[model samples]
Target: MTHQTADATDHPTVAALVARSNRLGGDPRNTNYAGGNTSAKGTAPDPVTGQDIELLWVKGSGGDLGTLQPKGLAVLRLDRMRALADVYPGLDREDEMVAAFDYCLHGKGGAAPSIDTAMHGLVDAPHVDHLHPDSGIALATAADGEALTREIFGDQVVWVPWRRPGFQLGLDIAAIKAKNPQAIGCILGGHGITAWGDTSEECEERSLDIIRRAEDFIVSRAASRDAHPFGPQRPGYEPLPDDERRARAAALAPVIRGLASFDAPQVGHFTDSSVVLDFLARERLLPLAELGTSCPDHFLRTKVKPLVVDVPTSATVEETVTALRAAHAAYRADYAAYYERGAAAARARGEEPPAMRGADPTIVLVPGVGMFSYGRNKQTARVAGEFYVNAINVMRGAETISTYAPIAEDEKFRIEYWALEEAKLQRMPAPKPLAMRVALVTGAASGIGKAIATRLAAEGACVVVADLDLAKATAAAAELGSADVAIGIAMDVSSEAAVQAGLREAVLAFGGVDLVVNNAGLSLSRSLFETTEADWDLQHNVMAKGSFLVSREAARVLVDQGLGGDIVYISSKNSVFAGPNNIAYSATKADQAHQVRLLAAELGEHGIRVNGVNPDGVVRGSGIFASGWGANRAAVYGVPEEKLGEFYAQRTLLKREVLPENVAAAVFALCSSDFSHTTGLHVPVDAGVAAAFLR
Candidate 1:
């Protein structure tokens, strides 16, 4: 059969390829995020030669197909890529082939070529797609996968037995296609599915057809078997009520995350989604989870396997925490052993093993609550959870038809420590200083609090924008980034219940808090004679009492995590400097200033640092000012409301207004490693207030 190929002006060819990739990637049933590649073989004109040259445009390395753009496509000269076969070495040296892809670039390639480049270029088709759809992997990992492939699709789709992905595997698939001219795709044993077609439309349709058929086949097979593929729910492992389960998860997240961060600090994601809950409650949960995931994409993010917490749904949070601590220790030991075994095997085979990445499991499974996945950042943690869910689906489908069999342990190790993968990791950008740290900033909806949150997020910290106004806080969080980077929660810091609930939400959102900024407060300026009981109480309750409550609750979690943290109180210059008609506010500010020193002394044993930032009268963009404090302060100072900032600036030694960002910068500096050894310190952002300066 002759295939019509697109020529130089066929830009639509690549566009259609991208569109098809996005469609397939958009659905979880088709492929997990960043787990697949799509390519179109077309022709583009060589600028110098003015001749149409055959080229291959494939999804590049480390990119998600769902969000693929033209620039994310790696362009390669088809002829040069095909020529790689001439000097190709054996499987032992297959990794070298990746380097050769650079030499096959068509001009400056738009993006780096991925490991699967050969699989697409070598295949004799204009369009090809390699996907990790759950249903397809289910068929791939089944014990009788090859026979099932024949039985299900006859000759339309063939089975290619397991071979670690590389140049050889690509050659193997190409050979199979040559032999089976009628074949449109193949199920890669212990891996995934790859489909090819004469046209882009045909390729996408064929890929979807394979996935649909595989899913239907699993459903049909399951109809004759027990409804629960993973076995009936274990007697004591049923899911708790939604509220209780979440509360338990929130309580447990910090402990699990801290343990997971034994080697390096990690951000975490929690899920009580139906699939995760169902899997956790099953009788076969332990055995299947122990067997680990089959697909390389699944294990790379989730680690070889997850650490499962053995506890009943009715177990108390304290009891579960005890169990988790013990489980984590054992998991670390087992992981070390696994690494040694793999390293020994590599040495025997005359290949030096790569250094161990980390002993901590990236994923943790609790019988009653849910799964907690951890990584260097929130997105990685979330993706790891998603990949594990895909693995669970694969296991369920595989069990429906036949015994589920993942690749051998040694094989998993080989891929896990693959030199190419290590190189890819090395190429990643250095992490930001605050990466993996979670911060909860009260009053973060606006003003100095929002500025601090923004700065922390910019430095790579996961931020929880906590405020009494949930909507404004949420909006602020959204402006900062996605849920992985920031989340907003309603937090009335003055209320103990609200503070506890808000911190719980923060823990659930990003494992635990490493930084807490007590920036929530209201200001009241009144003469001693005119200050009412209500004014005094409101000021004290919101600032002095609020800071204490937030600090106390956050300290409990910080100590429980056993991870050192920082708590910075946003005080005021009036804390030290005597100011007229500011009795109530100044007293509360003094209370906050003292709390910092007191907590710093108490929490030092736990490595928790407490500090404070004092700013002079901030008028512009100040929430307190906007709410009427500016006019009150201006009147007391005998200056116009608009001149309040300038008035304060002129009085300062630096003669510069202290904006919200200036206060934010001081907060950041205090929480940063720069101030690691200097706690109980008050940094004034009030230009140069000699009276307020620390003596």
Candidate 2:
């Protein structure tokens, strides 16, 4: 995607962009496996002349900045950016959230803005360039990282303690910009640095200088260390003679390919790191809480901590590696579960999914294991190891100091997935109809609403449960509670006026809304064919009209917020599969499903995701299969209702009936990331009963 022709000269401005990125560096090594991207402000079209504003040449996605080109840059209207930022707070969740990816936001059309785009936005410089510089990251992740920032940039740089990178961080910057006009650059605590100047060269100069200084600090600090910072492995730290440290590196070199490359008589391979380890081996070292190493970006080389994976050298190399692989899988799965739970909690609260990865899978802390800085290449891996080695040392050293608290779960998400993360890897999928955004569920009191709400919640959506039956919604909410779990509100999901009031209150609680599960239908009507119109009207008003009214109000909030949301109708399977009873129920179910498709097409353009879940002949549940379903089965199978489930349990090919909980889990699956790409699709949750594959 090379965009600009080389003028056969070094663009000083581009050089400065590159230089600025290197300033906070330990190593200006090309850290991102994908390289770097620099964006100069593009020219806007003269409205009357109809001329296009020229965009700065930035490296396109997958194009690293180590060797950059103009095609990598996305040409965009610098002026329209604020509006774009305000409109799309959760844009960071996109697989690729670059201004260049879509023509609509940040002028990125198919090309994304840098992963650090938002941080760059904070500077307000005409040009912004981001790179994975070793020195800057190392300095940022250090124990006394803030003091380092003060030592180098002084008052000129706005120092932000390590926080998750995301919309809120962007919002914070926007707020900070208002207060301090002179501040141009900022250091993200536990992250990296941002430098900006009126001219790209000036900014570049400042950034490069900063990196060199930070790198020097790293070198000197390593010299001051008495022992290996990570402490001694296998416990009971023994004082290692200096010569023994070099001997150890020598002995370990063959196993780890890269350490030997940097080995030298004057500066032995990993000597400084060795010193830090010896220190760590000491019994009284840095407390575990003080340790902070999450990324190669946060600290040039060590993305994760130096994991002292307790594997035996005695084991075959392949066997050891296999164990490591298994451990890694378990760690990832556990982390993913954590992510799903937290994300689901937020979804229940009726908000957009957190911008940062819920799991923070990026940084894994194995208590006694070596570290991992997942880079595109080995150089990146080795460089990251350098800082991780030191930081663990500092953390151990800091045991004398007060405990260091890492950023909170809410805060971590702010940075890792911040809207401005430098564009690097794959572009986020074009905004799916639903996306894995968050949605709130109301009328999640029990039965259908609970099932639908639970389903959506499980889909990794952050959901909220609101119902007149607060006890029930609360219980439901209890099931979903995690780090950032969903909230339970007491009220009706209906009542045009109540809906308005509840939504207003709920929206104020969370930032906004995305999806509304209109599951608050009530039924006192016994039978339509056997009963009167008054009975029917009551059912229609509460069940049918209530959903319509709620949908209208919910849509207003969704559309007004400008974040397209989803609306799932918990229509029953009776809509299509009729039974002798439930005449009124069947009519409402049919209407609910029919309404879903219409709503989907209408809101499609608004970026809203809407769908329906229809479950038929669902048996209520106390346990896996205890009571409510038995009577239904007993009657259907012509046996005593108690023996009914026994008859039907083997009826399906899978030998199961759709438990109410099964329906609930199904609903969640459909709305979560598993089914994010699917909308306007009616998902049936009747367990094979609908298919009749079983004899």
- For 364-447, candidate 2 gives per-residue lDDT tens digits of 222222223322222333344454554553354233222333445444433333334423323344433232334566567666
Clashes of 2: 113
* Decoy 1 TM-score against native: 0.98
Which runs of model 2 end up more than 4 angstroms from their true locations? 1-38, 42-62, 85-101, 104-110, 129-148, 151-153, 174-184, 216-228, 232-292, 296-307, 311-337, 348-405, 409-695
| Candidate 2 to truth, TM | 0.42
TM-scores of the candidates in the order shown: 0.98, 0.42
- Please state the error at residue 132 of candidate 2 in Å: 5.3
Model 1 CA lDDT for position 473: 96
Candidate 1, 1-695: lDDT as tens digits? 22323322248888898899889999989999999899999876786666778999999999999998888899999999999999999888999999999999887788999999999999999999999999999999999999999999999999999999899998999999999999999999999999999999999999999999999999999888856899999998999998889888888888898899999899999988999999999999999999999999999999989999989988899999999999999999999999999999999989987899999989999987999999889999999999999999999999998889999999999999998999999999999989999999999999999999999999999999999999999999999989998999999988999999998999998888999999999887789999999999998999999999999999999998888999999999989999889899999999999999999999999999999999987777789999989999899889999999999999999999999999988988888888889899898999998888877
